[model samples]
Target: MNYRIEWKQILKNKEKVQCSSDWISAESAIQLGEELERNGKVTDLYFYDEMGVSWNMKEMRKLLLEIEEEPHDITLYFDGGFQKETYQAGLGAVIFYHQGKKKYRIRANNLFNEMETNNEAEYAALYFALGILEELGVEYKTCEIKGDSQVVLKQLEGEWPCYEEVLNRWLDRIEEKINKMGIRPRYTVISRKDNKEADKLATQALEGKEIYAKTIIL
Candidate 1:
C-alpha cells in the first residue's frame, strides 16, 4: 500500500485531494492528515489507495489498525516437482500484489535434494514462497495462496485428511508460519495451464537453473 499526495477539484467547494501511501498500513495517513490540518495547508485530508479507493479518516484509521494485526490481499502461486532417481526436488512461486500505486511480482524458485516425495516438494515450494513473502513484509496483509496441486490445496484447506506424519508436520508448520505472519490465507486451486509461469520456474530449478526475479514489494 503506497500513496502519493495530489490536489484536484471536486464539486464547487470541496477541494479534491489525494494522499499517496499504502492504505494497507494506513497508520501514517491519519497522522499526516492531522499534521497537514495543523499546518493550515488543508482543512481536511482524504486518502485514496492505489486503486483510487477513498477512505475517511476514521475508516482509514480502522483499516490501519486491522492491518497492523491482520493481512490484506496478496496472491501467491506455488509449484514443485521431484525426481525419483536422486530424490531431488524443485519448487517455484510467483507472488503478485498491488498496494498504494505500485504493482509488484516476486518470482522465485529453489532446488533441494533432501525431499522424498512430490507432496513434500510442493509443500516446500509453498514454504519457499512464504519465506519470500516474509522478506517482502507481506505478513502484514491478507494473502491469496494459489497452487496447481490439488493435494496441497485440499490438505491446506482441510478438505482432505493428511495422514502422513511427515506431510502433516509440514502442514502444521505452514499453518504456524502463516499465523505468525498475521496472514489470512485464501487457498485456491488452479490448473497447471493457469500456473505456467510458476510451473516453469519450478522446472527450471529441477534443471539446476538459478532463480531470477523482478521485484518483491514489501
Candidate 2:
C-alpha cells in the first residue's frame, strides 16, 4: 500500500507548523516513523493510504505484520471473448500475487450466456476476477486491474462516458463490489499482445477447454 506521512514541525522560534512528506510505500513510511521516534522528534505521525484513510504507527505495524504471513499485493489481468454464433461470452482472468516471499499465479475462466456486447463481456471478465480475489482472502488491499478493453477501462476509470444502460449496470456492480471488499483498484489499459495470457484463457473457455490452476514460481 502507498501512504503519505504527516508530522508536526516546530521551529526554534516556537513557531509550529504541520509538515507532510511525499507519498511513499507503507513500509518506507513505517521505517521513517521509527527513525523519528528514535530522534525524539515524533510530534504526530499519521500515515494516509490511497483510500484516504489515516493510520498511526501502531496500526501500520499491525497491518504489515498480518501481510508478512500472506500476500497483500495483487495484480489481475482480465479478458472477455464473445461468440455471436452461440451468444456466449467467455471471461478470463490471470491473477499474480505473493505469499510471504513466494510468488504465484492463478488462471481462471468462465462462460456467460446473457452478455450481448463486447463491452459487457469485458465487464464480466473484471467481475469474475474480483470473485477470485475474494476466494483468495484479499481484503482492505489495493489490486491493480489491467485489461485490453479501452471501453471497460476508460468507463471504469471515469475517463470515458458510458452510454449503454446495460454497461452502466455492470459499472455499478463493479464499483459496489470494490467498495464492499474495501479494495482500492488501480486500472491500467494495455495492448492485446500484453494481455495474451488472459486472452488465451478466454479463447480456451469459449472452446470448452477450462483452465483453472494455481502454481508457485520458485
lDDT to native, each model = 0.77, 0.88
> Model 2, range 96-214, lDDT digits (tens) per residue?
98878789999999988977888888999999999999888888888999999998999998999999899999999999989989898999999999999999999999999888999
Once all C-alphas are superposed, what RMSD does model 2 give against the true structure? 1.8
Residue range 1-218, candidate 1, lDDT tens digits: 54433333243466665444443345556776656656554533567765566766677777766654433457899999898788988899998876554567878898988888999999999988998888767754557888889999999999999999989988999999998887767789999999999999998999999786867466
**Model 1 residue 204 CA deviation in Å:** 0.4
Q: Which stretches of candidate 2 lie over 4 Å from their true place?
A: none
- lDDT score for candidate 1 against the true structure: 0.77
- The local lDDT score (0 to 100) that residue 199 gets in candidate 1 is 90
The positional error of residue 59 in candidate 2, measured at the CA in angstroms, is 2.3
Q: Pick the candidate with the highest lDDT.
A: 2
Error of 1 at 111 (Å): 0.4
Error of 1 at 68 (Å): 13
